[model samples]
Target: MRLITYRHDGRIGTGILQNDQVRPFVGEPAMTQVIEQGIGEVADQGIPLADIQLLAPLRPTSIRDFVAFEEHVEGVRRSIDGATGVPEAWYDAPAFYFTNPHAIYGPDDDVPFPAASVARDFELEVAAIAGPDRTIFGYTIFNDWSARDLQSREMTINLGPAKGKDFASSLGPWIVTADELSPYEKDGFLDLWCSASVNGTEVGRDLLSNMGWTFEAMLAHAARDSVVRPGDVLGSGTVGNGGCLAELWGRNGRQAPPPLTDGDVVTLTVEGIGSLTNRIISGPEHGPAVPARRRDPARARHERQH
Candidate 1:
């Protein structure tokens, strides 16, 4: 079942998408609520998909983004280290970090390029919404928007991706339930292909099956010392080969492809999960400059920890 959360009748509504239309899941209230009830009984009335405005499937309860693709890691490392280098810890277990859930965007939303960035980029990823017993409730397209400059400069401090990534992350169009993907399943991997295009020009493509870590491993690791609750989300990180511009630039001898600019339309399509299309909107506004540094989000988080 393809589930959607959208605006209808002057208010937010939820429904199951079918045949280019939405069948409202009336008693469920929201996808998160319906998730709690279970995915077995999801049926409702109808509406044309073109009529309603959509939002992120649901504001996920919490989000954990895991780097699970070795090919992607090698691409990035080769760029930075001039040779491919996989971190030792990653070989032992899946690794991930928390991100701001508040910055999510729905399909068709216009993303204001985070002001502090010059090298604005996108990470192509797949995300799973949490369900009972650490299982996946469903999957959605995740565009992990990134500010390369800020991310690299901060990581040198040995801690942080704060301002670099916190600004915006997009997930949407709809969620494809796990059951719906069973036909495409193969030995714990989904036979799904993900590709991205910027302003109608194709930039990245990869198969979801190429991911090094499975959702089960990510969930198990995330829940090791804490609770993994309903409505939480976990990202598959970037897929193998070329999945982001940073990786692309890295692999291509640093000859940069055009970074996103105002009016650039970025569309990410996963053969089974559908697509999330967003436009980059430029604005004169910016957060405090990373160099100037008045307690930015990343720094603030660090200060509070001490």
Candidate 2:
């Protein structure tokens, strides 16, 4: 089932999405309630999906985004200083960072243009939501929008991606239940293909099997001494070879595509989970310009080599 959170008749509620139609669950209207009770427990009332606007499947209690793809890890490192080394900690355990949950957008919403960003970007990924009994609930496509310039500057400070990443993160058209994707599993990885495109130009494609850390491992790591609530989210960072301007700008130096601009639409698609698309809107109206503009990246890299 494709579980969803949506707005219809001026009210927000959880529903089962199918064939462009919504079957709203009676009484238990919020997705959190359905997730806590399990998908099978919800009862339904029918509504045309066309009549309702799709919202994000649900607001996760918290979000943990893991850098679980070796290629992505290596690529990002190379993008920075051209190093191909993987941190020892990444191999021994999953590495993740918390992101702003309040900045999330629904599939059909517009992502506000981040004012401080010049290297506006999108990270194509898959996200797992915690469901009943602290196990997997379902999956959604994730667009981890970024401000690459700010990210580079902050990384040098040795603390965070901070304002660089908190701008916006988009999830869903709907969440496909784990059982719905189970048939695609082989060995221990799901064989689903994930891809991203900007303004209709294809950037990259990767398989979920390429993930270095599995969902179970990520969720376990997230739980440490705390709790992985039923509405919590776990992200499978950027897919290997996924094109965000940051990674591409490094490799195609001087010739890379321009960073995301206002009005550009980005789409992240995972085979079983469906596509999450959002258009950019320039905004925040008041913030300093991205600080990385002061440095010449190409010249800096040249200096490093000497």
Mark the 10 consecutive residues where model 1 has the least summed lDDT: 286-295
Q: List, residue by residue over 1-306, the lDDT tens digit for candidate 2.
A: 899888888888887877877877777457776778766444555788779989998888788888888877776676655666687877998888899999889986999856767878889888898876668888888888888777877788778589788878888988888899999887778888988888998887889988886787788788888888887889988888754656665656432677888889888888878888899887767856455548788999999999
Tell me model 1's lDDT, rounded to 2 decimals.
0.83
TM-score of each: 0.90, 0.89
Model 1 quality (TM-score): 0.90
Candidate with best lDDT? 1
**What's the C-alpha lDDT at position 219 in model 1?**
83
lDDT per residue as tens, model 1, 1-306: 888898977888788887988877756487777777765454555788888898899888788999999888878766644566687877898888889999899988999766757888888999988888788889999999988877877777777578788888999878888899888887888879999888888888889988777787788889999998878889999886668888887888773786788888899999878889999985568557445646589888898999
Per-structure clash totals for the candidates: 0, 1
Could you tell me which 10 consecutive residues in candidate 2 have the lowest summed lDDT?
246-255
